[model samples]
Target: MKGIQHQLDLAFGENAVTVSRKAIDAGEQNLVLTANTRGAALKVFDGGATETGASKLFGGNLTASVSASVSNTSKAGTDAIHNTLDTNTKLTDLTDVDGNKLGLTAGNVINISGTQNGNAFSASITVKDNSSVSDIMNAMRNLDAFKGATVALDASNGKFVVKGANGQDKDISNLNFNAQKSSTDTTAVASFNKMFGGFTETQKAQDASSDNSLSMQIGANQGQTLAVDINDMGTKALRIQDVDVSTAKGAQSAISVINNAIESVSAERSKLGAYQNRLEHTINNLGTSSENLTASESRIRDVDMAKEMMEFQKNNILSQAAQAMLAQANQQPQGVLQLLR
Candidate 1:
């Protein structure tokens, strides 16, 4: 409604801003209104005491129904478009119990998968080149994501550079690029570079596409999380031993925990959907009502430019005739002078 009003202000004026604040003033207004309780809606003014100004909403009600008020004539403009178009995120992000993120990679990746011991969690990721060393260090430093995993470089000989100092057996899934940045640019990289649309580099850089990856490992049992192995470049898979639960019930219990967590997340999403629906319905009704009211107002108050133009033209002719008559009047006075002469 704000958006519509804004547009109307831009096109017409703030008198276009429609607000429905139909409240029954407690003592200020009174008139015997026809009992028309149709559709839980009470349109058709009852002339009932001028409504004392729209009824108030109860404590639990969200927003009270009000009539559109053309409060300001200059306040409508295009800036209110955003009010009509709302983008809301209703769901919580998908994360592990400890909130570990598995995100898209910019360039090629060499991943390492592994399991955990008593306190030490280990995994190794392979990088396409030594350029990944800094990236590896950075990921390791970010303990907030992979809370249980401590990352370091394993001894490298010639062809193989090892990661995962704690000895967690992790599989390697490396993302491969076609040769250069233009071949495979990702959003993460583009954001730093500000590629408006897709991954297309404005500047050219050689060897930018060369693959670089960092192997990583996290907790042994950070709860049952489904592992998604990312593989694009030449990479190998690393597997972990199945969790050893002594009894079937123990395993089922873990599964149940995972299920419950998933369900909770789903419930939150459902709530968001409901909220969005309710808002959308309200906005829809408001928009329709505003439009109808605005059209009606234009009919009532707005001067038709075309009609005004015609009126002005007629008045212009009359003025011209009046000027001619005044000249004739002056000639009559001259006649009096002639008689005196």
Candidate 2:
């Protein structure tokens, strides 16, 4: 009986069903309803009661605290060079003591070369015999290399000025200007070299900087909170957990930190929403698959009465034809008996 009970327990309780109960009577021992109730507790526990309870524990609202000591460092960027020509300079003044135009001859070339952000470029302007300074300046302005820089006459100072473009703090120390006369006009080379000697640097490069900071909080659990600090989101560990934003420096730092945190949280929420949608789709697909599989099983197991009846009629007709053929064969044997007589 013990062996039989063991086999029954294995076959019915653990294998064929989620649980099973058995009753046995022994001398002086009555199991009574003990076995029946024994499996009940196991069933309840195994039916996800503990799991459901745990899930409910986390269903409460999440809580979070944010403290930040964000300090946005303001490092200034250096400005590029701004230069002005001598106020009394004139294009026609480029002449030698002989009263002849120096490098200002037709076909004379003026070269402007400079570097911006480590990029080097050179532009050339061919002088027209009687072109004025304005015409020469216009030609230089049209060069691709000079497009990013400004070239204009400072009317207030009566000086020609060349400066870095607006908002660009480019270094201009490497910028240079030179003039070369046509080979035939060798007398003007020295005069052309002296023309650019009048340029004076008016402004030195200076750098600019800005600072920012902020503080915020996010929920982690019901009545519980996780602290977050927002620092430069571009930094490693992309979180600001312990920053203090009460002081001026802290407040400045918190600005960028808070902005980054907001972006991070928004992205996380978007990811969670995407995951939730994916899970819902997965559940729907599973349900549809289960339904389709169930239908297939039903079709495989179920009998079609109309088709079965047709098959039965076909077999019955075949049986009748076989019986008639057997009877005809037996009659032929009897006819042989008659001939023998």
Candidate 3:
């Protein structure tokens, strides 16, 4: 219930709608919602998603849902590909199945061709030294087809193995190998086949589970969004929906389940708190910008009454001085007229 309210506030602005849980009876509680404004309306739909704010608030469904869970089905992965060459023996001294040493020298190329992770690729591994199986395994890892796949030696089987990364499904197919003849070694292809041709698949590949996460736009602009992966908080998800607490053992089990539910809820609350803090900071920055812009607008549009009044008084004084000078000149002209008479 708190999750719903937090999502609402995050969607419709803070405090737009308040949701409160109140006890109606001894064992029942009612969820009460009070809208502080008339614009807040939550519309519940039947299908997948809608453009309404309510659809996004509820994670594009009728109810707030948990993240898409990975199917607990058996993990699908690629068959382990390995070579029969003894891991303890060096490539130069490695013996064939006939118990004869290969006597391979440097510059012998082991042509590896396979499709890893659905991409077809081929490469030649130049024998750096007959040192260890890692020379070949490491070289295989550098291939683009095996970019994210694993290539290692299986100690239990003494065979070099390759698998998908993190147990995910890897499409490895059309695997083949050949040895190219070099000037230093004419029998390189025959020696390479005798030592490395025993590669086989120990396991088959399978697919991974699907994800059920929903993407929600929290901000007004593009890319200002987050993926909401709410864990199912209902009794079924908490493992307490069908649990009976009538017996002592049942009650004990219920305690454990409830504790787990509390932890889950606490984790969700922590995420909500972080999101709220971030939104609050964004709102504060926007508010500060609004205040600064308003102050600038006032400075441009508002009049300075004191400054204007001072300019008016100075202009009035200049006009009076000019009138006084004109009056003095007129008096002098009148006196000259009297002298002429």
Best by lDDT: 3
Clashes of 1: 36
RMSD after CA superposition, every candidate: 35.3, 37.9, 24.2
Over 87-148, each residue of candidate 2 has an lDDT whose tens digit, in order, gives: 33455454322233444566777776766556776676666656556765676577654566
User: For residues 122-203, could you state the per-residue lDDT of candidate 1 as single tens digits?
Assistant: 3323323233334544443353323333333222210122233233333322211111132334223222122111222111
The C-alpha local distance difference test score for the whole of candidate 2 amounts to 0.45
TM-score, model 3 to reference: 0.32
lDDT of 1 at 312: 97
Candidate 3: C-alpha lDDT: 0.54
- lDDT for position 20 in model 1: 36
From the highest TM-score down, the ranking of the candidates is 3, 2, 1
Backbone clashes in each candidate structure, one number apiece? 36, 30, 6
**lDDT comparison, 1 vs 2, better candidate:** 2
As for candidate 3, its clashing pairs are 68-212, 76-206, 77-205, 77-206, 78-205, 79-203
Q: Which stretches of candidate 2 lie over 4 Å from their true place?
A: 1-103, 155-158, 183-188, 197-341
**Candidate closer to the true structure by lDDT (higher is better), 1 or 3:** 3
Provide the TM-score for each candidate, comma-separated. Answer: 0.24, 0.29, 0.32
